[model samples]
Target: MKKTNYHTHTYRCGHANGNEEDMIQAAIDMGIEELGMCCHVPFPHYRKHLIRSLPSVRGVRSLLSLLKAIIKDGPNMRMPYRDMETHLELLSQYQKSYEDKIKIYKGFEAEGLSVYFDYYQKLLYEHKVDYLILGHHFHKHCISNDYFGKEKMTKKDIYLYCNDVEKALETNLFSYLAHPDLFLIGYNQFDLDVQTVSRRICQKAKDLNIPLEINAGGMRRGLKNINGEQLFLYPNAHFWDIASEVGNDVIIGFDAHDPSDFNDAMYNQMIKFAQDHRLHLIDHFDFLQGDFKKFQSEYDIR
Candidate 1:
């Protein structure tokens, strides 16, 4: 295990326990070499709204009710931009402080292209973000903030999700995808039709050179007292088996939401799984490392 965690979250969004410094310290303890945080974008009730509009998620009204039920932690909960800038500043500092042990990148766990495509295209150029990790939290067809598991997904919704899978790669806005199989819109566990959507998905990823995350967050869900409902990390073991067979740009991340999640127990088995399946890790991504230099030339202000 390389101890490189590319998928991470912080306190500013909602879940996740640590601030940037705490995450870096945990990464150091875990011997993590590269750490990336994919925090949520600000003012996302509308994003979730787009996901709900999809025919895939059932009980849309109830889902909106659930989101509306979100209790304000403090006074500024209503204002997302204020919180976003504060969080971005903290992200920048963490990168500077932990420059030695880990190469930290500015990023966000952005919603699908349906919601943020227009805004994200600008943010990618404007914020100089290093990468964008796909987080399919769509409630109607795939899992939503209100629901988990596959009870709501329909074949059409699955198709819609599959299309988004392609769109995430096509948006030309993200570097890697966090959990590609989170929703499993079109294919079954290992029953993926390579000629169909899976093949296209891999082909596009290869063509565009976008890497997908072999997230270890799913394994953490098995832990007791832990909240795994919406946080992505499950492997969809069979889905990855096929993805590894078809794609070479696969990457791995702990998808850690907190400092305590930096333990070996969280990632050891997944590393073995990725190795067994022959999935490519982010560290091995040649184009990304090289393109990053170019990306830096174009975007890095400092």
Candidate 2:
């Protein structure tokens, strides 16, 4: 039996647990055919690679020596980038070493640039990345300044995330939307017109052949954010239900930050729910691949 956890996270994002290799090993242990490492694409300008998400916590910063070295030597002869390349080559060698066992996709969880488009473009060009997973983890307003506290996301923040997602759709950059309902992660605001807006957003996503996600890590059946109380991410089951109404383009996402959660019962329940509701596999896009139907047959998806 084989499973694929497409929406995954790594330590590079600053909050997620586990390293790259740990996730790979977990996938192997769990019989996953494919594992996608979806990390945050840092905006060099605003976020400085680490997002200052919580209050009293400053984000990761660049070293002045690093800037000087890059400026002096240019891209080819840099110290750490060269070191990083060498290390990455070793990581790739491990993949080659185990090519028969697991297939991996290297990608990033890109923040849909609300105000950091220029910085976003810099990262895309710099990395020339394979594929992207859309995450409005922090809005530009949140990243740009000291708006951090609890994850007290607002429905307006939902609007911001979707709006940025709309931009990612325009760029044709994302393979699938990650935890598309995350804005309600810590909060649930029922007053907003999230369904209408999300429906319109889903329409555009479907038109572009982009996949919307059914996240399993948060509220069960879309009640409210699991942590705080400010906004609704997808608004109960309303948004997922709306996405289901769109037919074969919606996707199921476990949003598995922790590897042990790979075989959690919630994974199957969500798949069964998506199967019953009729959603797409987000990984079907070009950058990576998986077959949810076959997955169910092989892995007891029910």
Candidate 3:
């Protein structure tokens, strides 16, 4: 049972639990062949102004410094880019130390900043990121500070999210699409609009030859009931049903926020989901096996 998940998160993202080593051990315990430490990429520019100013000017400045300290500690609250250097270092060290046991990869789950492509480019050039997965968790961009918060997405918003995803894919930077059906999180219903967007995404993925993840994080979080039907926000039956027809490469994501959740159950569920949908789920990705330097040169990566 060789399996790999390139959509894992770290404590630096302010949401996920566990240290990098903890995650590695958890992966080993579950017999995972490869584990990718794909923490959220930092948007330094977006973070600088996200934290509100305090009542007093000096106090506000103090707050900024304090937030910076927290970022330094790897919490990544109001600042994100601060900890990436350390994240890379940790991954590199752990990968070398544990090479005998299991395969480990260093990368980021990037929500590309379309408005600030230069900043995104800067990060790529600055760091030797192994791979980038397009995880579109926001509406327009992460800078909008807008979570996809509506109870039900309007047709316009659905298109916006899909467009953002397309833009990220066109950059030719991402190795695969993470949680491709994430747009359905807020949008509980399945209709023509959702189907259309899903097809558009799958079409691009087919064209690009990039794999789309059948994310397991949603199942670990718990199922949601919409219109009396139980389903995960992503790995939506409707979306995958369309994906099967579109014929895009698919992979499973552990999305391991807490290392303990990376278990046999998680692996089995992904296989079961893919089987139920008739998706040609990939057991391993060749992209993860090549030389990083060669990949960078080939894609002009950065």
- Candidates in order have lDDT scores of 0.60, 0.55, 0.73
Superposed by TM-score, candidate 2 places the C-alpha of residue 248 at a distance from the truth, in angstroms, of: 5.2
TM-score of 3: 0.82
Answer with 2 or 3, whichever has the higher TM-score: 3
Pick the TM-score winner.
Answer: 3
- Provide the lDDT at 74 for model 1: 22
What C-alpha root-mean-square deviation, in Å, does candidate 2 show against the real structure?
10.7
How well does model 3 score by local distance difference test? Answer: 0.73
TM-scores for every candidate against the unseen true structure = 0.75, 0.68, 0.82
Ranking by TM-score: 3, 1, 2
lDDT of 1 by residue, 1-302 (tens): 35576777777655567887887788888787877776665544543443444444347765554345333422111124446667677778777877877787777776564545655555665664666666755533322432323544455555566677776666666677667666652233333442355566666777888887777766766532213332223566556666778765777777777889889876777677778788876563431221233334334343
Clash count (model 3, backbone only): 0
Off by over 4 Å in 1: 44-79, 139-149, 185-195, 223-233, 284-302
RMSD of 3: 5.6
What local lDDT score does residue 163 receive in model 1, on the 0 to 100 scale?
Answer: 78
When sorted by lDDT, best at the front, the candidate numbers are 3, 1, 2
66 Cα displacement, candidate 3 (Å): 14
lDDT of each residue in 170-224, candidate 3, tens digit only? 7766788888887787887888898889999999988888899998877776777
